[model samples]
Target chain A: MMKRIGTYLLQSKYAISVTVLIFVVLGASLATSSFLTGDNLITVLRQTSVLFILSSGLTAVVLTGGIDLSINNSAALVGCIVAQLLLLGVSIPVVILAGILVGVVIGIFNGLLVGILKLPPFVATYGTNMVVLGISTIVMQGKVIYDLPRNFTPIGVGYVGILPIPVIIAIVLTGVLYFVLQKTTLGRNIYMLGSNAYAAKYSASRSVLDTVVAYVICGVTAAIGGIVLTARLNAADANMGNSYGLQIVAAVVMGGTSLLGGEGGIFGTVIGALVLTIIMNVINVIGVSSYLQSMAVGIVIILMVWLDIFTRSKREKLSRV
Target chain B: MTTKSLGKRIGSLPPAVWMIAVMLVFYGANTKNYFTASNFISILIQAAPLFVVACGQTIIVLMQGTDLSLGASLNMMTVVWVVLMQKSLPLSVALPLAMGTSVLAGYLNGLIVAKMKLPPFIATLGMQNILNSVALVASNGSSVYHEHAIYKIIAKSSFLGVPYILWITIGCFFLTMVLLKFTRFGARVISMGGNPESLKVAGYSPDLATIQAFTYTGFMTAVAGFLLACRVESGNPIVGNGFEFNSVAAVLLGGTSMREGRGGVGGTVFGVLLIQILKNGLVMMNVSSIYQTAIIGIVVLFAIMLDAYIKRRQEE
Candidate 1:
């Protein structure tokens, strides 16, 4: 029974991340007086909520054997547009829809480049990211748009039964995505397509536009995350999304989602997001200079990836034996 | 091949050349001082650092690998050079110390990609961030100003009516060309990208080529980074921000096959020229930096799409 359990753990992509998250929480709670506090934990959860939402869409893209380096910028652009509309006295509902519509358009543009046109995901998205950043700069005149509407506050910070709205939104989004990926035809198609593109093309169960659909979903999710982030900050700026570029990619990667695609899922991403937040928090509690945070994050990603690699090779050896 | 087919092939070269041609004409006609020799010199000098890095990046891409960390490593070298000088170190001591770190980074990147059995994309990216952090930590996360008269003199010196930096860039270009065109290691590098299996059949490990390519990139990035630091006379943490992307874009525009490794570093010179010229022209035309980058991004994207479409048609 122990051997079977061990084998299962070795085979599961998410097992390591979950184990890491739990151990971190246990260690931090024991060592740091501030770590176990309700306020700190809630703050961690809020950060995870925003990160997880962004990473979920990225997970979908990576699953299709592609990446969207522009997702952060797209989210930023959406936030900028939403902020402008809010300032213009537009209703909250319309503002939200408008943000999503902008996301959808960006998604379609990216979809054409990567899917139909067959450009490289990173190159296409990187270029698109630059364009998105430029447009946002022009949209906001490179200034922060503060003073968000009061009604939007509940979405970012207000609580329902002592749980933050962003957290609730994240949980609901994760559950829906988990169901869709596990139970839907589109989800299976994505998996097959990612695993072997040519084989998928010949398979009778294939849809020609599976790649496009994956990107579109990614776009929509990015918009949702952007709206929440804007509400959370109560402002928008051109460079706000710039920092998330590395973090989001790192989170999605840590979540056990392979960059090469066809393996891993939403659940792994949740753990990935939580673990990232805790690591950043630990850096703060330990009083690493705030300026060195970027370096610290870089080290965390390298170590995490190396650990993953080390474990993977060990798993292969055990299977071989 | 006959002259007719040679002319035909030239005519059918990728869309980037045509686009650059149109851009040159339009900007030349519209912008004041766009066609002057002084502007040309300024653009070439501006392209110098990027051109040098792109030459090294050419080999990396030719081997079907990417070094997302080059820019960061370059950034690290700049700050390290300055910090060492600030500590009263002489030129000989400061130069090697700074250059060695990035070379080491390149070596680590090679090991991660070739030996650790990890993908180059993530490994290099992780390394890039680490190097970026190191630069920040070394210089306290801001610009470091130092009075390095040697670099300033080197920057100001003109040999044969051209600045020393331009000479260095030109030297690196020819060096890269000769290395790619004449060396056995170069053959192995190209083969590693074109077909790793064939390399093994020829009794050369593709892994060694990968390592060698990365090390080369490290050395060139150090040279370029330090030169740029001298030109600007300060160690800015983010000075090397866009070189990685710009170098890759230059490589692509040069018509090097990213997948097949079918081109040479010789073409990358023109690609670098195109980019620097475009930026200069836009600056002269009063375009803001942000929008200028956007336009360049769009043009690059369009060229890539057109190239892909043409390649697909050829394959079909």
Candidate 2:
């Protein structure tokens, strides 16, 4: 029975991540009085919601064997612009539309650059990220905008029947993504291309289209995540999304999605985000230097990727045998 | 015949070289006595450390790998050096230790990227974060100022009408050029990027080449960080900001392809100079620093695309 359970966990890469999550939850609960409390849990979940939102789109890009480093920076740029408009007394709904529009534009730019022009994803995204960052700083002129309008905070911090609104948005977004990845033609195309691009080309005619759509999804989700995060903090800063640069990616990879693209799902990413949130929450509660937070994240990313590679090699060996 | 050949040589120069020529004329026209030794010295001072860093950066880009941790690890090295000096450690001990720390960080990156087959950006991104945090933690979240006589002298010293820093930058550029041009390791490094199968068939391990390239980059960036700290006489954790991406841009702008080892340090020198001059001229002309980054970004993208287009046409 025990061996059977081990086999079950190994079959789906989610087992290791779930096991790590459990251990972290248990350890955090044991060590800190401030952790494991209902209020603290809710707050942590609220933060994880942003990861969920961004990772949903990123998972698609990663599944297609590409990455979108500009997502967070582009979103932050849009957020800064949107905040300026809001300060001018722009209506909330229009502000949201404007944000999404900017996201789609950036998304299309990334898609065309990476997919059509055949520039390496790193060069394209890194270039776009720098441009976004430069524009962001110029837009804000290096000043932080505090005090977002009161009603605008709902999608981020508002509670719907004792559950945070961000969590609801995350759940809805993840559900849509999960459905699209598992059940839809576009989803299969992404997995096919990611697993093997040359072979995918012979079989799937719309591979390029699928790749563009994946990046667009990534961009749009990043935009929404930025908007929500800004509302939650009630401020907009160009560097607000700086920390999110790799954490969303970390979550996606940790959740069992291979960084090499293909072979992962949105549901696993949820657990991955949860694990990171708990780890970060515990670090905060323990109050070890806040700077160490980045150190911890860096360690997590390296460890998770190594683990992924190790398990993949093992699985391949087993198949050969 | 000699004159005709010389004209052909000038015509064969990369677009970046021509762009630099145009900028020089513009700056020389606007800024009085721009070609004077004093003005040249000022530009060299600003370009010195960045050129040294780009010298190392050129190697990795040739291999189609990137060290995103270049700036952050350099920050860590400077921070480590300053903090150790502040604690009354002798320069002999502090200097080696700080340089060693940078090497160790790069070694770790090399291991992860080459052995584990992790993406260069991902592995280096992780290292970048860790090194940045280490700098912050070591310096206790504040800049450290530790002045030494050596730093002061280096900043002021000059030989033959050029600053010592510029001389050092030139030394680093040639050292890198020699390493990339005349060495078996250099040949293997380029081959590993463009045609790894060839290297493997020739019984060479591509992984070893990758590690060596990364370690060299780490060592060079450490040297750069030391030079920069000497000029400023302090260490700030955020001091190396924007360097990581800028180096990549410089390498690409130098007519280097993203892969296939199509360009080398010969072109990277001109690339680095172009960027530094553009930046220096903008500052000299009083362009707002805010607009400068955007302009740099646009220029970087446009140049890279143009290079790509030219390469594609050549291939056809």
Candidate 3:
């Protein structure tokens, strides 16, 4: 019974979160005297907000055993488009809407190729990412765009009392996404599809295209993330989100979302994002070179994946024997 | 009977024929200069490195694995080769050392996946990060802009009016093709991918096959890097930032299945030809490079879908 309990604990993604939280506490407490201060914690939250937002969508796609590599490039493309529009004197709301719409189009293209046409998600997204990045580069001509209107900046960098706007956005978005993923018929269908596509197809309760739409929704969330990032920086660059692709994936995996699909929760992803943010902040506090961060992050990712795999195999073995 | 045999001939041409036809048509229509002897030669020379790498990548993808570290490995190998040669090491020594580093890197990736049981995607992704840093550290973020005479001439000189690199690329392709078709190792690779469990039961480890595929891909990627070093007469840190995608796109376009156990070197050759021609044709036609890249994505999607459909039909 003790062994079984231990197995259950190991298999639970919550176990990893507890571990990360413990590390976060230790790192925050030790790295800087003010790391536990409300302001510093909020700053970490703010920094993690965009990744949290983006990974929310990616979590869904990954649940269906698919991935969207286009998000980072999509973010770049949307950032470029919005920057161009903002430069041309577009309203904040219009730019935001257009940014999301652009994501939808790219997502649909990815969906049609992967869902309807049966292309591998990796290849389809890879091609789309390159295409999008290329377009973004052309749009920006390798230039950065600043001069955002006042109202738009608040969405990313502003505060309501003690909380950053992006943190609030992250919370609200997480709640809404959690509801959609855990409660709705559509959400249930997505889980079904990811668990077993052929089974879902035969159940008379799910559609592959609808699941594909879910993947598109993931794309849209990533777009929102780009808009927020642009607002935070008060400028949009052509390669703004170039490094976020792997980072977001790492965040999702650490959150215990299976890349094979059909498992995990948004809440876990939020915590995962927090862990990543704290790690980055702590690294900064420790005065490590920026280049070394990637290597460190890579090692952490491998370790997390191993733990995930180990816990999963342990559970599978238990269930069988 | 002849009609059925004729139909079989058409069927046997592979779905990649459409991609080949599209490239040829575009190459012809885009410019009066496109199909001329001199330009064709130039295009082939331009495509040599990509083709070599694509051939390697195709083999791995055929095994249902990917090497994200290919680009970083290429960059590292080029830097290592140049920096080593500057220390007065002979070409023979520098070349082997570089190739050895790449193999070790690839072997490390294979070990991580096969021995450690990490997902190929994640493992290769990790390797890419590590190698990127290693490359930076090796050269202290410096560019090697000068090299020996032979290195420069390898990219510039031609035998029989073809760049020496082109000949080397062709040789690699021929060697790869022969190995894939005629070797025990190749047969084992296909069998392992076809059904890993059955292969395991038959006393062959899928891990071994996977390692072999990765090692080949690594070595060939280094070869591609060496050619690029020759072409530029210098090794820039940023030279191989996105070649992985180009190789992958070429392989996917050539008629390789993303799933394991199918595809061949011939398909990859055609795929590389198609990609190179498309890029060249777009340049000739004055299309924006962005739109050109977008078109390649669209074309690759169309080709993959067609391949999948035909494959499904065949299975039925």
- TM agreement with the true structure for every prediction: 0.95, 0.95, 0.93
Q: Which candidate has the highest lDDT of all?
A: 2
CA shift of B220, model 3, Å: 1.2
Please give the RMSD of candidate 2 to the true structure: 2.4
Best by DockQ: 2
Q: Which ten-residue region of model 2 chain A has the weakest summed lDDT?
A: A197-206
Which digits, one per residue and each the tens of the lDDT, describe model 1 over residues A1-321?
Answer: 988877777788888778878897888787688998999999999999998888788888888888888888899999999999999999999999999998888888888888766777887887788788878888887689888989986788889999999999999989988887779988887777777854735553234477777888889888998999999999999877976777887787778777767888998889888988887887789888765666666766777667666766778799899
Give each candidate's interface RMSD in Å.
2.1, 1.3, 2.4
Error of 2 at B183 (Å): 2.3
Pairs clashing in candidate 2? none
TM-score of chain A of each: 0.91, 0.95, 0.94
Q: Which stretches of candidate 2 lie over 4 Å from their true place?
A: A1-8, A197-205, B1-13, B25-35
Q: What is the lDDT of residue A211 in candidate 1?
A: 74
Off by over 4 Å in 1: A1-6, A197-208, A303-321, B1-7, B12-14
Sort all candidates by DockQ, best to worst: 2, 1, 3
Q: Give the per-residue lDDT of model 3 (tens digit) for A1-321.
A: 987668768767677776787878797788788788887877888988988987888888877778787888888788889878988888888989999999888888887777766777877787788778777877887678887888888888998998888888898889988998899977777776677754725643235576578778888988888888888888988788766867787888888887767778788788888888788888787786666666666776777777777777777887888
Output the worst ten-in-a-row residue range by lDDT, candidate 1 chain A: A200-209
lDDT of 2 by residue, B57-163 (tens): 88888888888898898789889999999999999999889989988887888889989888888999888889999999999878898869878666778789666
Stretches > 4 Å off in candidate 3: A1-5, A31-34, A37-39, A197-205, B1-4, B85-92, B139-143, B313-316
Ranking by lDDT: 2, 1, 3
